[model samples]
Target: MNYIKNMEQEKALFLANEVTVQAGQIVSKTLAQNPHVSITLFAFGKGEEISSHDSSGDAMVLVLEGTGQFTVDGSEYVLGVGESLIMPAKKPHAVFAKEAFKMLLTVVFPSAT
Candidate 1:
């Protein structure tokens, strides 16, 4: 099945809105979902953060707006809009929004056991 659409209507699910996180508020949305991939959009309020955790599969984070820091295995890396980071399976990682920011998070999981 083809899910592609024209740019005009594509903005429907790609818009931003407020979301609440442990540290603060954020604006986010989910763009796509399939058996193999899931993509979500995030807009984090300043100081917002996600606690460190490990994933069962590989994941990718693409910064879409503002600034923030991502920690992988205890090492911190500054990130800005247009930047992307990859997290391998079982590695501990987290993200903190230094300022209100937007991002796209994509995760690819292993086939069902």
Candidate 2:
């Protein structure tokens, strides 16, 4: 089974170019998903946002291009290219596009034993 999908394997490529930002939309591409972990790529148009929510797993976001605003437990943070942040599990977090941006998100869940 392919744990990672929607992307080429063993080839040179830019993670930022894996997805695209639309005029007024949020686009996402899931690279891997399972009970243990999830990896995804996102492209957001200016003004786009993901409303506040809590997750069962810790989530990390890496900025690939442009700028993004992250709200974690009501605290706001701005991130630019090559920056990263981790949203602790069960913490209310949200993401917004300060400008058109791309990001890689990885979440790791506790073992489902």
Candidate 3:
């Protein structure tokens, strides 16, 4: 039985080591990969920003829904909606929403071919 129901009419949305961004209407989704672990998704609108980054592996951030501010290495975290944070690899992270936000990010990879 092969059954896949509607991921926007599903035709290749399996993003391995993924990153998606849309500004103007504001949309952002980022996933790393898995079968070991790596996943990311972020959506923002009202003052969206995701700048400053550094990671070769080991990352986690989950705040699915409105309000956000997460910055590691410089230390700043003010999040809402089920908040979460864990970051270590290259160590430099950033995110800001502050009104419209949706996020779920997980990345864990060191060595596995």
TM-score of every candidate: 0.76, 0.97, 0.31
Candidate 3 lDDT over residue span 19-105, tens digit each: 334453455443335446766566667777878899888787777666788889999988887878887889998887777767777
Model 3 TM: 0.31
Instruction: Answer with 1 or 2, whichever has the higher lDDT.
Output: 2
Q: For residues 1-107, could you state the per-residue lDDT of candidate 1 as single tens digits?
A: 44422224524543333223334676556656777777777878889889999987788988776787899888998888788889887999998888877787888
Which rank order by TM-score, best down to worst? 2, 1, 3
lDDT at position 46, candidate 1: 89
The TM-score of predicted model 1 comes to: 0.76
Please list the C-alpha lDDT of all candidates, in the order they appear: 0.75, 0.96, 0.68
User: What lDDT, from 0 to 1, does candidate 1 have?
Assistant: 0.75
Q: Write the per-residue lDDT of candidate 2 for residues 1-113, one digit (tens) a residue.
A: 66899998889999999999997999999999999999999999999999999999999999999999999999999999999999999999999998999999999998887
Badly placed stretches (over 4 Å) of model 3 are 1-9, 12-35, 40-56, 60-67, 77-87, 90-97, 104-106
| Collision count of model 2 | 0
Per-candidate clash tally:
1, 0, 2
